[model samples]
Target: MNEQGEDTGIVLTEAQKRARRSRSIAIAVSLVALVVLFYVMTLVKGPMMLVRPL
Candidate 1:
């Protein structure tokens, strides 16, 4: 019984590690996308667009 419990714990840890890695990758991709979006917006609207306000 104890060995089975240990095996289960190990499996759970591995699964958790994969989930964490996936989440990190997703966050990184999102940040990159956000940066690209901002860059494009700046190019289309001009650099001073933010300073002028609505």
Candidate 2:
């Protein structure tokens, strides 16, 4: 029992930390891949893709 008036004994294992890090890295890589794919698609589509109708 502490300031919160309860036993706040929560801890993460080494394997859990590693898993979290791996998941974070995977998400970052996925986002970067999506950005690259979008850029490539824009280039392949040409300027016509940017044309807006009024």
Candidate 3:
């Protein structure tokens, strides 16, 4: 038995699932924001600049 009195392989609880979903949504939003920022920067200049070396 695990700490919750069940097997260690137990699936996530409702709250845990919700938390995971929220995290995923947050990640998606952050990615979208980054993409928008990149697009805006590229539009402001002649072309996208390399912020870091490849």
Candidate 4:
């Protein structure tokens, strides 16, 4: 493996970087929304959600 001036990967263009960042933020927002939804559902369901008939 030659270490001198080794090209690890192609440099991303400004447009590509912006697009990648936008996608990342969108995904993060989606995941956060899902988590909030589940939390809200748990609150709305109350303790009865944990109680099951044996």
Best by lDDT: 4
- What's the TM-score of every candidate structure? 0.66, 0.67, 0.68, 0.74
lDDT of 3 by residue, 1-54 (tens): 877888777679999999999999999999999999988888876444656557
Worst 10 residues of 3 by lDDT: 45-54
Q: What's model 2's overall lDDT?
A: 0.89
Error of 3 at 22 (Å): 0.5
After superposition, which runs of candidate 2 have C-alpha atoms over 4 Å from their true positions?
1-9, 50-54
| Residue 19's lDDT in candidate 1 | 97
Q: What is the lDDT of residue 19 in candidate 2?
A: 97
User: Which model scores highest in TM-score?
Assistant: 4
Tell me how far candidate 2 lies from the true structure as C-alpha RMSD in angstroms.
4.9
Quote the positional error of residue 48 for candidate 2 in Å: 3.2
Candidate 2 shows a clash count of 0
- List ranges where model 1 is wrong by over 4 Å: 1-12, 51-54
RMSD per candidate (Å) reads 5.1, 4.9, 5.6, 4.0
Q: What is the lDDT, from 0 to 100, of the residue 7 in candidate 2?
A: 86
Each model's lDDT comes to 0.83, 0.89, 0.86, 0.90
Per-residue lDDT of candidate 4, residues 1-54 (tens digit): 237877667778999999999999999999999999989988988997787778
